[model samples]
Target: MKVSDLDVPELLDVITKAISPVIFKGIDQDSSPHLWRERMKLHAEIVGRITAVLHCGDEVGPDIGEIIEICTRNMRAGYEQSFSEVLGPGGSLSKIRKP
Candidate 1:
């Protein structure tokens, strides 16, 4: 499915469901709204790009197994800083600072 086809809530649900088992491992319950929103936006962008490549029959992109791995890797890396910031001491959202 195209990532744009899913709304914010649906996207969040998909992400949460996909990573549910791993959430408790390190996710911060106090995650900030801004960071969470950015993470989700990044996730959707990546998903959409990957989907477009797959639909074009790109060899590497057409592989579901590899696609999932790429998506997960990209998302994890993209959110690492945000996740760490939220989960860090003093319950800070420092990672959301302006560029």
Candidate 2:
């Protein structure tokens, strides 16, 4: 499904359910509203990027397999930074030249 078609709360719920006790430990009860909002925004952004990459279907676009690798192997920058790193620059996406 397109990222625009996604539901934030539902997406969060699915992720939370899928990961179990390994939850996004990035947020907590004491987290400030502003901090939590920023984190949530980042979560949405990364999800959108991943959805975009998977749907692009262009050879030059980022690979879904590689993106999964990053998600599983790297937790240093959370999700957004790591996905963006895999995507390289926005220019790289622009270089796709739709087929």
Candidate 3:
């Protein structure tokens, strides 16, 4: 069955779960606008693609990891740009937290 066969709310819930980590931050949103903007952009991209995949139903057989990888790739580029803006010339990666 096509994803469109599902109700709107169900479709949204599936999409939300797929993109949960990106959209579900708490106080971070209140404190960090720049980071939040990049995150939201990634969230939107992931959700949009996931939604399309779902809408395509069995034809494409999309995987969540594929969606995440795409989001991460785009997000990384956005983050690099955001870091450049915030850190300034030769600001160094010291400000970024080490994982």
Give all candidates' CA lDDT scores.
0.53, 0.48, 0.58
Off by over 4 Å in 1: 1-22, 25-62, 89-99
TM-scores for every candidate against the unseen true structure: 0.35, 0.36, 0.43
- The runs of at least 3 residues in candidate 2 whose Cα sits more than 4 Å from the true structure, single-residue gaps closed, are 1-26, 58-99
RMSD over all Cα atoms, model 3: 8.5
Specify the highest-lDDT model's number: 3
Ranking by TM-score: 3, 2, 1
lDDT of 1 by residue, 22-79 (tens): 4333335455655565555556455545543443342444466666666656656666
**Which whole-number lDDT from 0 to 100 does residue 88 have in model 3?**
50
Candidate 1 lDDT (Cα, 0 to 1)? 0.53
Clashing pairs in 3: none
Clash pairs, candidate 1, are: none
How do the residues 14-85 of candidate 2 rate in per-residue lDDT, one tens digit apiece? 764555333346655454544544554555555545444444344434476666545433432554464454
Question: Backbone clashes per model, in order?
Answer: 0, 0, 0
Model 3 bad stretches (over 4 Å): 1-5, 21-30, 61-99
Among these predicted structures, which one has the highest TM-score? 3
